[model samples]
Target: MSTPTDAAPAQPGVRKAGEDLLTVTDLHVYYGNIAAVKGVSLSVKQGEIVTLIGSNGAGKSTTLRTISGLLRPRTGTVVFDGKSLVGIPGHKVVGHGICQSPEGRRIFPKMTVEENLELGAFLRNDKAGIAADKERVLDLFPRLKERIAQKAGTMSGGEQQMLAVGRALMGSPKLLLLDEPSMGLAPVLVDLIFDTIRTIRDQGTTVLVVEQNALAALRIGDYAYVLESGHLKQEGVARELLKDDSIVKAYLGG
Candidate 1:
């Protein structure tokens, strides 16, 4: 099981670049007695879109959940913006400027689109800012604006995915954690979703996404890490990895 520290040596210039906004050092997460993430380490620089790509049961979602405070790491640390996030409760994680659009598009089924978005800002009291953000989210997902009064469950999968991301943005996150944004979407919707991710990054929020769509994710990512069976197998510039024969063979279906 190679770790990021050792893996970096195999890929020169893969070390942390610029200013790191989020750093996970030797992270080890467990589900009951089984180790889900085994001594993984990675970093996301400010304003960059970093991705974690792997197959099923590779601990990709587990890493995001740990970073978002949904799961506790038995060892190692999660540092965001120079502050340690270890042991922080899940709900309070949002207040610290990290927000997650989880694996499944977990939008409020019974709530209208607008109401679901408002829930993202639950920790904030700045009414004006919240209102402004709502407009911004609507603008990002114009389809959402059209369905503002419609129930979230009634929307299509792509629309609900957009809503999930929009709701996370409404929280005004400094670092956005997106888990499997492209899962289960049609090819056209996948393109739209990945495009939207770039748009979000261009808008100035840093992103750390866990994705199963290796090709699409690597195409837009600044940097990427490969997780396999709870281990960090590779780490490098996304474009560089895209050209690697082994990576292409294993993850890109070449």
Candidate 2:
């Protein structure tokens, strides 16, 4: 298997465009007897939005879980900012500057919106920095600011999704892992979520998104990977993939 130092080359003329921040090489993960991720290798640069676009059950979420330390890889390496994150506990992953807004939002339903956002900074002690980040998140999702005292579960699905993204931002992540941010939202909210993702990237947080919304994901991503049954099938500049006949037909519903 290829290691981080000697992984296979990326697609021709599709080299990573910025400084490498996260590198997953030859990653293999399993659930009991089921091999979920098979030798998946990908990279995220310091200031780019890279997306994994694939169908359900394609191991995209499993890859994100492993990178966030929620699940351990049975083999291979997860190197973030040059340090191996293979055995780091999930909670500690936040301290290393990576945070995930998992699929299904996963907010504390009974908690107020503000309370839920506060929990994201549990690992930090820098009061001023945390306060600044809260304000930043609120700015990014002003709807959240208006509903700060409302119970999270009382909100609509789109609102809950915004809160999830905001909560992840409260952690002040250098690399944000967003899984299906547009899931279960109305068309308008989907547009808003994608807009917010671009804003997040413009504001300096690199993002690695796992999205089934292929067209929308490709629109905002600087680069993209197409995964099929736990293996990489295609990868290239997002615009290039968007134009590819095969990619459009298979994932973009062309």
Encode model 1's per-residue lDDT on 2-40: one tens digit a residue.
334421324544544588899999999999999999999
Worst 10 residues of 1 by lDDT: 1-10
Provide the RMSD of all predictions against the true structure, rounded to 1 decimal: 5.2, 6.0
The lDDT of each candidate is: 0.91, 0.91
Q: What digit string (tens of lDDT, one per residue) describes model 2 on residues 1-254?
A: 22322111254336555668999999999999899999999999988899999999999999999999999999999999999999999989889999999999999999999999999888889999989999999998899999999999999999999999999998999999999999999989999999989889888999999999999998888889999999989899786787899999999989
Worst 10 residues of 2 by lDDT: 1-10
Q: Estimate the overall C-alpha local distance difference test score of candidate 2.
A: 0.91
TM-score of model 1 vs. true structure: 0.94
Q: Candidate 1 — which pairs collide?
A: none
